[model samples]
Target chain A: MRSLPPLSIFVFALSLLIACSHEQDATAGSPGAVDVTAAWARPSLPPHENSAAFFVVHNRTDHAVQLLGASTSRAGVTELHHMEMDGDRMRMRRVPSFTIPAHGELVLEPGSNHLMFFELPAPWVDGEKVDLHLEFDSLPAVDVLAEVRPL
Target chain B: MKWACLGLLLVSLGCSDSDAGLLDFQGIGGDFTLTDEQGQKFSLAEHRGQVYLLFFGFTHCPDVCPTTLVELQEVFQRLGGAGQDLQILFVSVDPERDTPELLASYLQPFDLPVIGLTGTVSQVEKVAQAYGAFFEKVALDSAAVYTMDHSTRSYLIDGEGKVRYIFRYKDEPERIAQIVRKLLP
Candidate 1:
């Protein structure tokens, strides 16, 4: 597919806005049995469109844990999606389950495991926070913040 | 002799430590095979000695894809003629609509040597999975136009074909350019 390139100056401004908002944690993230944080909304999307919330999930337990499901009020439904391909096709599947083994971590960034909002309840007025109710096997379900970016 | 052996063991372990979260376990960069807009086959192995910026999205992407690529072009231009060996690849996550001919024409306007790639639905899926990129086709029953929602990211591959960095779609151009400059020949 193709798109007309945007002007260089607007690109610069957009880059600057994002640079201030994004933070990378190579060492440690949310301190909980099942950790999650760094959530952000897709800035360019409209209300009717699907949006993804990116974050990092870490499991510090001795036994493996699974991310069974997710719930969010901001959107009608949320699911744990893993990126998969049959051959030349790239599609995100709502996995039956995903395991974060003992002492292991899952980074739900742009490309990996992330929360998918199938149908947003309303147009994301940039900067609003959407809450995701995270579900895990043994860990108590917790709510995480997803910051909406101005489109 | 015991002291010397302890030093050697510690050094070996230290050298072995690297970020495990980002790369796959095989120790090889994820495997991918797709056709370029010019009807030419392209693979990561073919560009082992040069740095490349990669973006995975459909040709019809309305926002993130174009925004990310333009920033990359700015970085490439900032690098001047030194970016000649550096490749910028756009892999179409939506194969149903993106053909080689469409991809070729899509990249014609860009100042850089940008190659647009597309393959069968399954073929492109494999490519996206290999890079850890995610995409989903949005179905619209009423509207003629639909969109493929995808990861808004660009991966930076070093000369050795290792994915060294995954730049956020909104990262600063100068920081991206700095990383490219260090990897450039």
Candidate 2:
């Protein structure tokens, strides 16, 4: 078997070092990298009705994470809901959990996956904020503020 | 794939119909009288010379209804001067909760003059059937809480009050605007 030239061996070793350091830096720099962004809810048009909230969950960690569920004080029941397409019909149902892949994002937005609040005591008026508690597996629950905007 | 190809063919033909300044649409909608947002009698025949978009929804709808109306508003804004000739009729399927006052307040965010219409359950059902739409009251639990499960399609009616196009809920505003501009005088 032929051996690599000295110069080529040095270059290969240097490249490997650089690549490994970059990955280490990426993982070490981002601790508990589940980020919640753009949290907002659509104002309940009529009081005591169901309302929906939207947000983007970005996981920068090197391992997958599961969004177990959510809670809110403004409504009697808060559940994770997903919109399903059956043939041409669109339907919504409660989902037990959602997964966010390592270094990926899970977006909960209008007409897709969303957090549904049911039987709100009062309408989530525009310009007001709702307190949200997001639970995940093996991580501290995240307390978030979601603003309400008129649809 | 075959249906997609056929749809493309129909779209091309629709484009030609637009160019001809006459939409050779199979007649679908007819005159119906309902109470408007102002609690006054509204007759479809009265708007004979204007183009209009019609949708079936209620005040309590969270996702689909609001999204569709906002998209239609975008289409109307895109039409600019021609938009003035376009009227929007939003018929409430849940007549019990969607009074004229509720409808007016629910639609305030759009900042457009979208007329809200509602009537007796059978009256609304008859009109929805005529437009090839579906709606039902879905009971959620034993507490008597209910939600409406309804179709999300919007109908485009021309100056002659003939249904010219049925826009899907996901249709882009620009795409609907293009067709509406073609139908407009």
What is the per-residue lDDT of model 1 for residues B44-100, given as tens digits with 9 covering 90 to 100? 777667777888876555345545666777888788888887888898987887788
> Which candidate ranks first by DockQ, i.e. highest?
2
Which digits, one per residue and each the tens of the lDDT, describe model 2 over residues B1-185? 99999998776546446444444444356778898878888989888887888988888776888877878778878999888888888999899888887887777767566899998898898898787778888766412266677887788887777877778787899988988888777
Q: Write the per-residue lDDT of candidate 2 for residues A58-139, one digit (tens) a residue.
A: 8877788889989899988887877754543556556788999988999999988989887788878889999999998856
Interface RMSD for candidate 2 relative to the native interface: 3.1
Give the range of the ten consecutive residues with the poorest summed lDDT in model 1 chain A: A22-31
| Each model's iRMS | 9.1, 3.1
| Candidate 2 CAPRI category | incorrect
Error of 2 at B173 (Å): 1.7
